[model samples]
Target: MAGSLVKRQGFGTAPVFLTSICTILGAILFLRFGFAVGNLGLWQTFMIILLGHLVTIPTALAVAEIATNQKVQGGGVYFIISRSFGITIGGAIGIGLYLSQAVSTAFYIIAFAESFSPIFNYLLASDFNILVYNYRVISIPATIVLILLAIYKGADLGIKTLYLVAFVLFFSLLFFFLGTTEYAQNMESIPWDAKILNGKSFFYFFAVCFPAFTGMAAGAGLSGDLKNPSKSIPRGTIWATIAGMIIYMVTALKLAISAPPGDLAADQFIMQDIALWGPAIPIGLAAASLSSAIGSILVAPRTLQAIGADKILPNSFVNDWVSQVRLKSNEPVNASIITSVITLIFVIIGDIDIVAQIITMFFMVTYGAICSISFLEHFTADPAYRPIFRSKWYVSLVGALACIFLMFQISVFYSIMALIIMAIIYQTTSYYKEDKEGLANIFQGVIFQLSRRLKVFLQKADPDSKEDHWRPSVVCISSNTFERFSAFNMLRWISHKYGFGNYIHLIEGYLSRETYKEAKECVNRMVKLSDSTKSRVYMDTIVSPSITSAIAQVIQLPGVSGKDNNMIMFEFSKKKPEGLENIVDNFKLVKSTDFDICVLGSSEKNFGFKQNIDIWITSKDYENASLMILMGFIILGHPEWKNARIRLMVLSPEKELEKQRNKIRELIRTGRLPISLNNVELNEHKDNIEAKSIINEKSKDADLVIIGVRTEAIKHDSIGIFNGYEGVGDVLFVNTNKEKEIK
Candidate 1:
């Protein structure tokens, strides 16, 4: 399933331990630790060690937890991340990780060449005329040899080389600890205290030294070759990390006392000076650097090969070529060529400090991602995510946060650049990737848990409480969904920001094998329609035998936003009112639930440029007046109605027109409605003129007209009360069960 799709060598845990220790003790330990000690002093150096391990140890534990939970495959950490986080995010980080590993190989090779500096200087003094330009002469050649070895002999040769180097690494440390120098013997007169140097700040030193502790993951690179990865990975990585930390603390103490700050700061080979045998220091440095290089070389290609096999790259041919392996050994020859090309370019640059900074940033991102995954797994409480080795959620959170904190602390520019690069990779991968699974899939369980808790909490809260601001929790049911979009558009606007809406399409049949399939298909179509409009409305299909039953079921259903649905809407076409009679028949059945009702009469013009809305209110419409005004304001919140204006038309007797106008002015001013006073007109109403005729004459040009409906009129006239608004673009007849205070 991972890394060129081939069988592995099935090596055991020893290789994991040896590979990691060799890397943990590599060039940084011998070359940079003394520099860190002399510059930051003993106490601060120890603090750096602790801080660095704060990131590594938790990450190591997270790695252990994740490794035990899944069947680990060839790409090592990449395999684990992709499987857990899904392909898009995994591919993004995998690319960054692959580059870090490849560049890391070059980093080790350059350090290996640095070990030959004394020999090169002697040759120059003896006039032997060896080619030299800093360490490039050695590094360039060494890079070529390492690449060739990796390409031809593969991981087998690399693993065997690790054992040999690990042995040499032990003696070198032993000799360094055994040796003592004149600088050390004279240090008894001086007080042991932490000193701050004038140049190269503490965090700078910390950043340089931080990469030393990151070697715990080196063993994980050999995941494809391991005999039993589940058993080996956690033990090897955790033990190696613990051992590395202890050794680093001891070495810092030794370096602090053995040499004066001046010698330790000036001399790159301060450890050699403190060693009993000076040559052993360089030999160990060479062994450690070479072993680290071999480890990186072994892993980098497999990650790239796995990425290719997963089809993360854009080109098909390139994917096929890079993913292909040698038939017998399962060696990723083509992927190694790509990795070698990257390594050679960086090696030719030949600056270890610059390369170290780049590696640090990428590795920081990788560690942070791993810790985030572990924390999320614990939070989601997924039954499938039960790992044999479990890490505390808080520990993983700390690790993730520390990685981010240290990244910016080290270099803010690099941290931002690293994040931007990863984002670009994620976007690119998402474009080419066919799978819909992404962050949503990763967070599905967390969202489920949150939603469940919220629904329960909202249910328990006092629904009768009047302290909360009034917002519609609306649900609309329609069999004429495809025939008219006015109701759906209204629902969308209601839920845009301040409210919630659910649109249910009525599938007129009992729930059964055939009806269920039809309902599913109808729901899918509604989903597509919802997406096309970028609506926030939740949609579904109700497979019930009658419109009344569907209405009953929908009213009983909980709101999508966790609050109880407070409003129900019915829609019918003005030209083809096929469901009007059924809706009129069920008005009382719905009215029994104390839900405010809206009957939308859709027009041929479909809300006519959607610019002007008129609200009609009489003296008897105290409850409906506030509801209509609120609905108008809420509809205006949507971008589609952003340019629309609301006109509140209050009708009264000729003498009471001024009184009604004063009340509306108070209402608008008190409630903070956007309706201008000029837009709030009080029209004189004669008792002889029909209300519908006056409405048709006044609001004929309006895009939408909202008027209040009394329960007595609805019960007396049934569907006839809704028939007189033929002149307006579209009409909304609203009724409320309770008073809605604007404030």
Candidate 2:
């Protein structure tokens, strides 16, 4: 073993202390993905990571002093602030901290979701470009399965799962670092030599390094529930910060030596570049990333539970049993679930980098506040108040200043967003003074307690409002038989996932007039589904309106209640709608009372896993179509859409509109048409050469691309889209249909 003996007893450290170390590791790992900032000069990166240790040390010491001296009554941020400053400030801090941590978990889940992109593409196909695949289909299943697993088994399973994840990450990163190459080359390329940044400019870069220091604070965020927070919290905080700094320094040094800043920032996982380090490093790095993701899954929920326990959140949110060390697994079950749900929404919003940058800004405010307090405490001159392991006040001051300064570095847009978050918290907390406290306390912790109560009350009063899915359609019938309800059930799931609203249908065709009169009895039984489901339904009796123009008729009526957003669900048969399906050359229509004619297709059959559903892209559509092709490509490449393994590309021109994309999907279905609803980007995308290049890259591994003749003549040297201008010969490029085996 080429190991230098570094002492670490797996079980020796206080649980919180160990937690801090792991926490810092997780933060360091955060720097390894999605929208990484430039690696400042070598010396700058080095100083921040190295000096970051000195910075976090003061707050850790201050926490120890307060936790030990203040008589652990509550020992949370609220308690810490009350003892140091006052209760009012503590209350505000409490609320803001809760939100900070809540939003922070979003970063974790987002990272977790993004980290799996490699695995997702690996499972589906190689060269997983953003525009080519759908990660939602891949991640949603994993997230849903995990979420359901967590909710079903309660909190215990989630915790146990996290522990396993930690172990995997530790070993994996170790191996990746060992395998990575060009370390010497990277070291030689340092932008500047060793010159420390002690001036004001430190702040912008400080923001870059702040996450390195926050690891200890992360554990402190969990102080209320720690096994022995006083001793444990101090040890964990101090050591974790040191470890984080070391990681930042080493990783920065390693990265600086290995690649240029431009390359480093772009790679995200610079350590996992297999072309440079051989393939083994990627696996190891992946393992490490997995570990960090799992840790977020475990600890992120606890902070929410802690907020609940303090009586800010609903008591129901604190359903877990954390009083005993053995039952800590049950401590914050409801809060965990809630956090998970909240995180899921952010994940669905896409863009992980934007979410993370916003989080860094949000949390920096809290970190700066904490560090400032520590600086204030450094001068109190009380023996008991002195930190067990205190550093100079200057360190804390720099940390605070750095935090303030770094907050500015995170883009003007994010700065505004961070302020908005702060404003929202202040407004909500002040508007509802449920948790009465003072600002002299811990910053905004008071607001936290009050907000929790209001949130809990709101939840109880209205659970339906929180449900983001569309309501299930009820096809009124006499019985709950599957044959009678299959269409309703299918539409309900599709509507829920795709945001399509419930469609109320009164069966009026095929049978005699007498039979149609009898169908009214069947409506009652069919409508039985709405009672079991929360989805909304429009009650339409099709007796008088003998369905004529299915497409045109459905577009004229006002949408059913709560079933509004861009989606209208209907119960039409596969063999049934000739009136609706035909003449509707550009789309399909059902006889309903709503008119959003641009709306296309029925409910997505495989809404979650949309990969098997082929998309037809032609050169012609690229020039004039309305959609963000790049974003679509990225969404399609999401790791969540694992089931979306097969993507067929049809490169026809004249059929470049919606009709063409749909027809290509028809080609893939082979007969009964196995696919999801047409997922076109409502927004328009340009057909520039650069965009085309990206498309070709996305289409590189495509299963099939059906080509149609181009409207214009093709130059001998140029490639042309078919079925547009005019052409006898057309090129059909099915990726899988290559003469030579694709390697």
Candidate 3:
């Protein structure tokens, strides 16, 4: 709910098309085109225009297709990305897109001020510094006026203004074409060589030209306002892209052929001199700049509003303030205010060249991500990803690669900076995105395909030949985990990372619909526990009159094909639980199914924070020794217990204590455990001392204690030996056989 909103539709295809066209035909076309043409010559300038569109068309197609497939709303590009990739990634890119749009608004307004500087010169007749300084003075007021216009009038007025700007832009283009034709007829020779002038590479010109085509997202950012976004987005976006490409190619051809390269390269404002009417150039520049600024101010606030509503931003006060909408127009009033402040700062302090390059990098990454989403959706073939507008997966893949390639070509340092910034945002927002239900995105489909392939590969492999690759596959029985949480936590810690656990809860009633319903509810609770503990647990429930029979049946079944359950575990209380005798009788039944046994005895106090582990060693029961030490390592591997220290303790006669210590040290060294000889302790006492008493005395301070269970102990009461040591801490009584070896 925090990351989503409902939007009202108002725009149609004409407004969307005009908005996209006006944004692409920005002030840069008038101010920066001559620079690009002069540096790269005629054919290469044309290539830059064509290549920019080539990289952008796929992103436009991806946006249109994805917009049609979903119920699109105010977030625009961010909404599509989040819905496709989930909240974490969506939040990251949304912030970046929002900042880019805000900065673009200032960039355009500053460009507008610069275009009118010649008029200021005509009036003031002052030095260049005074005129240039006055540009900032003009830009601050211009930014404020646009922000107020956007907040009060909303996108409707923005679209209407774009309509007027589109007319002016086309009229100016007509005069430019007419004037260039006359100049071409008079000129005897044209410079056609694609040579770089003033030590500029093709990439430098490409960077300046790239922003010309990046405005395709303007229509996409207004997705929430479209009357029929599903139909209008594809039609409007494609037609606008085609129109911009044609205009760019035509303008590049005319600029290269009509003027001398030396003259074109000398003047950045050559458009004004070359136009049929000189004033029309500055007028067109002003119109284009204002229209693009208005477009950005209209769309950027909505993106901010979307992210704020979804609670992705860190500050709650800021989120609540920015997400507020005006009841009259449903305009992002507060978001627009925040965006205006950021734009004003950029206008005051930001350098146009540096800001332009940074803006290009941000947009390149955004476009790449869009194409990547489209490619993944097609490749994974998720049933929910059906779209009205479809394109080939390879096409989307190529588009994504091209966007990334061009980003580095433009500036590797800026590209890396943009990527690092997005990554940090992703990490921060992912920490706060708590709604798991909202995580249904394309990654789920990708993971599903990967898991399916892995299952196939595992099924075909030889089970016996891969014994060395085996890890623990455990089946644990617990009626109510809350009542025995320590036992459950112990099982989770032991099976963390390298093993899988199947937790079964058996209902003590006749097999009826009511009992089955109750069992299912219990299973859900167990699943929640598994998620909270960050453990790999598959929960199952069964309604049976005989608890022991239910457990035995579950143990006999394999969790995955070709991987049988190798260990069965139960919780031990000092006072025997109900069906204790049946459980004891089923131990042999479990062993017949090739499973070892484990029982946990929990202390009354919660487990300590001290990371100390004690294991009691007697004779060389290598199987049990390996299993116990492995469990110790697993416990220490957890982030909370990373500092845990393990010790192998043995009780022996005084004369043989040294021999026992050497033997245990040799075992640990050969076993390659993360323990050392200093950790192996031998306790020598008189013949009157019992092994259990020795353990109780020595391991009282340890957080966890592990002791191997003999066959005789299993045959009698398994919980009796550990009764005196329950107060020490959590304890695991491990029994192992030669049937299965854990890797």
Q: Best lDDT goes to which candidate?
A: 1
- Give the TM-score (vs. native) of candidate 3: 0.72
When sorted by TM-score, best at the front, the candidate numbers are 1, 3, 2
Candidates 2 and 3, the one with greater TM-score: 3
Question: Which candidate do you rate higher for lDDT, 1 or 2?
Answer: 1
The true-structure Cα RMSD of candidate 1 reads: 3.1
Clashing pairs counted in every model: 0, 100, 3
Model 2 residue 660 CA deviation in Å: 99
List, residue by residue over 610-687, the lDDT tens digit for candidate 2.
443334455454321112121123233434433454343434434344666565456336632223334332212344
- lDDT digits (tens) for residues 325-427 of candidate 3: 8765678889988998999889988476787788888898899999999988986788888898897788789899999899998999999999998889888
Error of 3 at 589 (Å): 3.0
| lDDT (C-alpha, whole model) for all candidates | 0.88, 0.46, 0.78
- Summarize candidate 1's per-residue lDDT along 1-743 as a digit string, tens digits: 55654577888988888888788888989998888887878888889999999999999999999999989977888888888888878989999999899999999998999899778877777868775657887888888899999999998988888888988989999999999977678776433564546746879888888988878888887787788998899999898999999999988888888887767778888898889899899999999899888889998999999899999998989999999889789888999999999999989887757657868899999999999999988888888898999999999999999999999999998888889989999889989996746456659988888889899998899978875588899999998788778999989988998789999998897889999998888889999999999999999989988888889899999999888899999998888887789989999998999999999998997889889999999987767888999999999999999999998888887888888877877767876565788888778888999888889999999999999998988889988888978888799989998878777
Q: Give per-model TM-scores.
A: 0.92, 0.48, 0.72
Error of 2 at 53 (Å): 5.2
